[model samples]
Target: MKSSPIGGDEHPRPLIREVVVINKQGIHARPAALFVKTATKFRADIGIEKEGEVVNGKSIIGLLMLAAGEGTKLTLTAQGQDAEKALAELSKLFEDKFSED
Candidate 1:
């Protein structure tokens, strides 16, 4: 939940957030598509990390490759003018269980 600027003042550091997948089905195709769709709405560069693997958040294939399941913890990183807003919306998706039951 900490969004500190890194790389000094010259560069905007990516905002990082830790979120857990709470949906019953986790991040399957539908959820991944939803995530990518939402991510694409922002100009920030989005990255989703699980364990040590990081993938572009706007790529549905990348998201599916993570194989993240319920209770899985993922790190979301965004860098750009709307980085904070992007992280907030993305994290809200996780918090809301991707709008699934």
Candidate 2:
């Protein structure tokens, strides 16, 4: 995992956040595409874990396999440069229901 300091201090600790998918459509197709796009914007290495299965955040296919439906909670982990920012952005994305109604 690529880990960076939360504030550019050089620490190598990874950050984690719990997010729930609340969108009616869950993370399918376009929403998954949007998620992958947002995740790739950061330099940190990000991954999503559901139940016991973990998948790379940068992989659209991996994300789709998650088959996360509404109310499915997921653990988001990030390490490397901008880990905090990555989690924050991702958390916000999830809170926004991936911009879906």
Candidate 3:
């Protein structure tokens, strides 16, 4: 059998990265909204995973549901032509502490 590309596309594999919540407040409403905003800007399909539970990266509610507190590690996945770029930007948000200081 032929192997299929991720997200039903020609992309070899979905870009995956592990990020830790560095913000003091974690992914609360503001951060969730920002995350969703950023994720929506990319054409790639994005998903945020916490302990195996994955949620749509474009959904604010989904992000908020993770309850990803400070220091919590999460996995981010993206599949599409811009998968690499998407993951880069998304992971930057985590590293920047969502700009919440």
Candidate 4:
């Protein structure tokens, strides 16, 4: 996931926010799949970042490579018409612990 810098003058348009993994298992295959499914619902592009590295949120392999653990912090970013809403809802998904509620 290539994210346009949130503050940098990079990318004419930018959308980025940080979210924590509330899921006890972190971004494992199952949760990653769910995340990708939700991400694909939006027209905007979605990406995830951890430990300074970024990868496509819709890509299972890429997300798995992140090796993110429970409570690990991540940055989510989107670009396009629904960027803002997509980011918000996706962040909420994390906050909700992947719908464990």
Give each model's clash number: 0, 5, 0, 2
Which residue pairs show backbone clashes in model 4?
1-55, 1-56
**Per-residue lDDT of model 2, residues 1-101, tens digit only:** 53333455554777989999999999899989988998999888999999989999999999999999999999999987788889999889889988889
TM match of model 1 to true structure: 0.88
lDDT of 3 at 23: 92
* lDDT per residue (tens digit) for residues 24-60 in model 1: 9999988999999999998789999999999999999
TM-score of each: 0.88, 0.88, 0.87, 0.82
Give the Cα RMSD of candidate 1: 5.1
lDDT order, best first, reads 1, 2, 3, 4
> Order of all candidates by TM-score, from best down to worst?
1, 2, 3, 4
Mark the regions of model 1 whose C-alpha exceeds 4 Å error after superposition.
1-11
Show the lowest summed lDDT stretch of 10 residues, model 2.
Answer: 2-11
Off by over 4 Å in 2: 1-11
Give lDDT tens digits, candidate 3, residues 1-101. 33335555556578899999989999999999999999999888999999989999999889888999998999999997777889999899988888878
What C-alpha lDDT does candidate 4 achieve relative to the native structure?
0.82
Q: Over all chains combined, what TM-score does candidate 3 have? A: 0.87
Model 4 lDDT per residue over 1-101, tens place: 54445543333365999988877888887778888888899878888989889898778899889988887999998987667888988898888888663
